[model samples]
Target: MQNDASTHPEGPAASDTPATPDAPVAAFPTTRAKGCPFDPPAELTRLREERPLTRLRYPDGHVGWLATGHAAVRAILGDVRFSSRYELAHVPFDTGFTGELPPAPTGDMTGIDAPEHTRYRRLLAGKFTVRRMRLLTERVEQITTEHLDAMERRGPVVDLMEAYARPIPALMICELLGVPYADQDMFQRHVATSMTLSSSEEERAAAMVAIDEYMRKLVMGKRTTPTDDLLGDLTTSDLTDDELTGIGGFLLGAGLDTTANMIAFGTFALLSNPDQLAALRAEPGLVDQAVEELMRYATIAQTGLRAALEDVEVEGRLIRKGESVALSMEAANRDPARFPDPDRLDLRRKATGHLGFGHGIHQCLGQQLARVEMRVAFPALLTRFPTLRLAAAPEDVPLREGMNIYGVHELPVTWGEAGGA
Candidate 1:
């Protein structure tokens, strides 16, 4: 697998506007606006307003399309004419991998198209269905409760990130994949090394090699032992040991980090938006909508890329073959055409159909699992500590930088005492 990423490809909106020659090529956004941690970069909003689908200049000097309008982005994501294959793509923003990208490795479904992708998707779909994810809710709650109990015992002051947010999804994914929870620390270390732009190519390769070997061992073990996890269940399928290993590694990495960020970053968003928080606390049933709003509001998996396989028109603009389109999921989520009063953090809004998880076929495979985790975990955290507030000022909390996923490095939180939700 090239890299584990979150992608949502859905339908297009009719309002995709054409770009004019004099219009400046949109640059990939790097900074959030001052004082508003929840909103997309101002430049993104401007571009979305002026040219929903505009020219984007990549660092490698390739001129491509930037799809910021909600409709256009969803349309592009859903249209099979745009290939998700890495070999066909150009880096929308410079996150190190430049020039012509290598074809996706075997079993990395995100970077491939059509028949191969269909096969992997077909095999894994049943395991992550809504019914299956709903079943995991009880397990998610147990894991969440364990962490919350730990945090309360430790003290009022804690980095809720490490204490509460990170562990819940990690435990769930580990259990589902039949990976020993004892080895999560090791998995995290290698996964971290593999993801960061600063890590040397050798380090990244070594990390992959280590992960590949470990997964292969796990697959081999499952083959002989046939335990009761996702991997164990898949062992009965016709997939070869190599294919299963690749998938196991992919699922293991893809499952945790994004949901973990949603928990931490979603909390930061709620704390920052007190009115929304108060409203939810007053009526805990809104947790479902609250989770949806938070997904739209925080949008942890911020950006995605796809390339055109054939000449096709999206909105009013023609996308020539071989050209890439850099999708701003954050900007699309905030599109006023699709979302009323787009910038506000209103938990009461029906925030379903959000591109925060992308749309169409490649939409996040574990999104159901994520929603279940967040729906249970967020209310539990809020209820357990009604007075929960950020220990450090929101501005002081360091945001995850240069990474594909958006979140805080740590969330220092404190509460006065237990109270009713």
Candidate 2:
């Protein structure tokens, strides 16, 4: 992959209007905006109706198209024209370090496209199959109970993020990866640092190196005494050591933050929408529908990075080959064309398909695991603490700024005693 810094694409000429620029013209915001791009802009509905494809200037001055309309966003994700392999391009954001990171000790499966992506994904498919996820349901429930139980002892007002949101997924992933329970702290620390969007380049690099080293050692140990864990399964398969490490890294990198954000953001959503919360509390069976709605509304993966494989015309705009583009899933989720009253959080909405988990061949492999986690976490949470409410003002809560994944930095919540329901 080429690392030519000068390859950054130039922005298009400015337009007259501030709110929505006309097609075939690039418009740069005067100052960088923090938080998720989907933070419900004051004029988003108007912008969607007027300008579906708007030019966005990245913090690094790299220019790309941001697709806002639901149909357009879905086309970009599902179309063969747009490619996820953009490590070679001088894009500002990191695409989950799928490539452009140091050579994977195990070759990276995320960097490769299908047949190869399909093959590697297939090997691990069984691990995340519905049956496997069903087996994990009890363990997940237990983990959820433990977190809530701990919160009860310490609570009144609790940082739900620290007390519940972070640990449940962290513990579940540790269990699934077969990493020793005692070593979870070490792994969690590494995963936390490695996944930080606010960290500097040096800090991120250091974290990645530390995680790689840890995985290498774990892979070496598994090679000799393989167990029934996911790591052990990969080790015993036809995968190379490097391949094994890559899979492990992929799981570590993908699993924790996304699910953590889901827990945090989902909690915030539930609290902010009391009616929805009460509805779920009244009918606990709505957990599945509620999770889907949260995924659609929250859309933690705010922007996906992709490069134009070849010069392609999309929605009447010409995209040059190799130019980087941000597939704004958040914008797509709220597009009125796909979802009527897209802004409202409706639990009964017929969510046929959403780009919350992405689309096409490169869709998320751990989606099943994510669904299971949410399915277990939400219902149990509502049932455990029926009176759960936000401890902080919604406007005052600090959100993760300028990160690929949209999540709150902290979610302070209050609930009744553990098992109070």
Candidate 3:
């Protein structure tokens, strides 16, 4: 909505620290309260309400602006004046990480600015076009059906995260990358290890190396004997062996983690809100809307980081050059100004313009595929198990609190045998 920061409601000042007369500042990375796991940190909400573009003290001791308002967040992300160079930006939060960030790895687009980013984005863009992704609809449906059938055969109670959520995306990504079924377990092992927040830096680094080595070998195989998949098709392109390997690893990691989390988290959100779950079951047509709403409500990709490449005035605040800015997607998506009754998970709500997939040039490249997967998966799960409900208490559901991605670590669920549709 409103882009003018001055016009935003100025509530009480943030309590992180005292603000000087010249610069309004607060600490970055507020913690989410225990009972309010689904909601953004209360401090973020307060900062957004009082001063959406206030100064933040990064963990690395860099003071930069934190954009929590929907408009401010979008404005920063859309503006190329901001940098996405991973080494240039500080996370300003607990990552068990310290010291300066390393330069953007060979093919990780998340850590680079444009020109280079533009090149990779352009090369891969054609593969993810809406039409191409839509073509996968039948395949997605088949995949969803197979998983549901397996669940039916095996379950009275099960960890849906393992049985349903994790595998769907993992399998889809494997198919897309043309990874052999025989090697999927190995591929998936490295991926899971690399993404674990609890893993030591050395462990994570080793996992990445293993993943890259495998990708390099996979790319070489595709070069000699191509197949009909994203990676195989890319072999025809002029990309170098190393570049192809990097891109392959990047896509596999991105495609698998985010969507898998959304599926598990979406199920948790709906189960917690029985009325919304019922609405989806009663009206299967609501699946599309529910997907967007759940993405908005879950806001799984909690925050985005950027550094000002040059001084720029945004949302009426002056952000100096070289300062890292953190955009709180979770907060902005739930901003009351943008979405009324933002906390309520109304499946019927026309939740357009959500930052769930983000916005701007670096917005998720695999969004269409993720949407198609969700559009099919969510409804199918509900339809297959009408009486599906959580077996664990809501509070006991383990969440990935300190992880880079926000989601449940596991979701135990059960359903009546006769409830299948």
State model 2's lDDT: 0.70
Better of 2 and 3 by TM-score: 3
Clashing pairs in 3: none
lDDT of 2 by residue, 124-216 (tens): 888888888878888888888988898878867888888888787778787788776667667666666655565666776687688788888
Off by over 4 Å in 1: 1-26, 417-421
Q: Write the per-residue lDDT of candidate 1 for residues 1-421, one digit (tens) a residue.
A: 1342222223332122333355437567667777777788898998899978988876666677888999999999999998888766667666565445466766777788898888899999998999989988888889989898998888778998899888999999998889998888798778777766667667988998899999999899889999988999999998998889988988887776788888999999999889988988888899989988889978877777887777789998888767778888999999999999988999999998898788888988998999899999998999998899988878899887667677887999989854321
**For residues 1-421, could you state the per-residue lDDT of candidate 3 as single tens digits?**
1000111012332233323344545466558887677899888888889877778776555566789999899999899998777766666665566755566668888777779899999999998999999999999999889989999999768999889898887888889889865676676677767766567778878988998998898899889999999999999988889888998998888877889889999999999999998999999999989999999999988888887776688877777666677889999999889999998999999999999988999899999999999999998999898889988788999997766678998999999854442
Best by lDDT: 1
TM-score of every model?
0.92, 0.85, 0.92
Pairs in clash, predicted candidate 2: 105-242, 106-242, 106-243
Assess candidate 3 and give its TM-score to the true structure.
0.92
Model 2 residue-pair collision total = 3
| lDDT head-to-head 1 vs 2, winner | 1
Model 2, residue 352: distance off in Å is 2.5
State residue 233's C-alpha deviation in candidate 2, in Å.
0.8
lDDT of each: 0.82, 0.70, 0.81
Model 3 regions lying over 4 Å from their true place: 1-26, 417-421
